[model samples]
Target: MRYGLAWCMSTFGGPIGQALGLTLAEGAYAPVAWMLLGACWIAALVSFLDGRRRRRLLASQTGLGSLRAVDWRQFEMLVSEAFRRQGYTVRETGLDGSDGGIDLILQRDGATTLVQCKQWRSQLVDVRLVREMYGLLVHHQADAVKIVAIGNYTADARRFVHGKPIELICGDALLAMVRESQAAGTVSKQTRRRA
Candidate 1:
């Protein structure tokens, strides 16, 4: 998915670019040659600009909230839009007790995924949320359970997801998905309707 691609690009590409800069600095090529070579890097800049433009288009269409005014329901809607943009058939159930701990159910390629959204602004998510989601996965017989915390997770919470069937998506990860979905030009119809 584009979200995964963007994460990989930012993580790996940063180090690669730094190494390339070091290599260029130590090379036999003169300053003039380096300057000429630097001009070729304009392509990368253009690509980045194009991506930014596409993200702006998506933001315009989705009408996402800024950090200053994001509400819980809006955060949930954003998560739903993110999944839908990734080609999943998403069904949001809101805060219902029947679904156990699952907040949203998504289906794609015959696989059912349960999602839990936490829209905390300051508090760190704890392990209880992860454990509850694991139990809900069993109750729902879902293929996977994803816990999306719109804030940082505590150390224990992160450890709980490691080596478990449940996946933890932190605030940064969710934001990255939204940004990537925007860049990919895959805004969800739900978002458009809400707008």
Candidate 2:
């Protein structure tokens, strides 16, 4: 969605601008450089602002630790940002509504984890979803799998992940993790400044 576009624009902006600078002019190095620099700066700045805005929204909305108050898309982004704060590189695979299999893929310390976010409101997430994600682990080559549910899971679903590599973060646990991740990020920033 917008996140993917923003990331792509930010990531390619610098290099593409530089390339344009060389191709657009023959000897006008000064003008080209200025324009390219401006382009690159604007792209990077917009991306930074968007990411900061999303992160701030994530923290502020989760302050109450209530998941039902947020919209479905926001929940997914919130989950993504929470993991990002926890020092995991998170990538959103698909767009907003059509997230084929996994919503997020996380990597940290050379370990990869696939995450499927379910905004089931008050409904109990079924075992079928969990089993589908488990099947995708090998296909995605992930070290583990996690299911993030805004609501609770079915009894059968809970039993399914027992002794399995799949970790289910129910509503309560998900909120706690978000709070913990944000707190960890705060402490990390403070420690860096003190050092």
Candidate 3:
């Protein structure tokens, strides 16, 4: 918005100035237009690079974006990294192999969120899993519960959390997060540290 508005102003201000009988220098318009164009170009370049990095992050999550191809561990790591990119300090609790239902804890803006990364691709994730995550919210003292599933959830699963603080992240929603987190940072699958 910043650069775009500058671009519009510079591209039109000279003509408007002329119409209003403002005596601007002849060479003024070109330089201002060039400057505005440069700024817009830079913003465009930055946006493009950020978008490309985010796409890469989303694609490599499942090794070419196929959810079924990824193991549960990789999916969990991907969710953690995604949260990390979104300015959250993500702590991976699932690595201990006995996390008691919580996989990742995301802390940001003085709020804590518990995330359960469920890569249940073979079958629909049901209400039991959602209930387990909800139950941990009080035990862990978390502000919210998020179930990040690579696959879809059962209708019962969705209905269980209606009017609740539980957030269900499926494939499309996860991709949206990847896009929104572009400014956060790029994540390399190989160098993605556990947790």
TM-score of each: 0.60, 0.78, 0.61
Expressed as tens digits, the lDDT of each residue in 1-195 for candidate 3 is: 335444555567686734422322323455666887999999999979855654564546433266556677666766776787777998889967787898998999999999988777667889998888888997878899998876789999999999888999987887677555543443444357654
Best by TM-score: 2
Off by more than 4 A, model 1: 1-68, 95-99, 186-195
Candidate 2 C-alpha RMSD relative to the actual structure: 7.8
The local lDDT score (0 to 100) that residue 119 gets in candidate 3 is 77
Show where candidate 2 strays beyond 4 Å: 1-26, 29-31, 62-65, 192-195
Clashing pairs in 2: none
Model 1 misses residue 3 by how many Å?
52
Per-residue CA lDDT of model 1 for 159-194, tens digit only, reads 887877888887667777777776655445466778
For model 3, name the residue pairs that clash: none
Each prediction's RMSD over C-alphas, in Å, is 18.4, 7.8, 14.9
- Pairs with backbone N, CA or C atoms under 3 Å apart (clashes), candidate 1: none
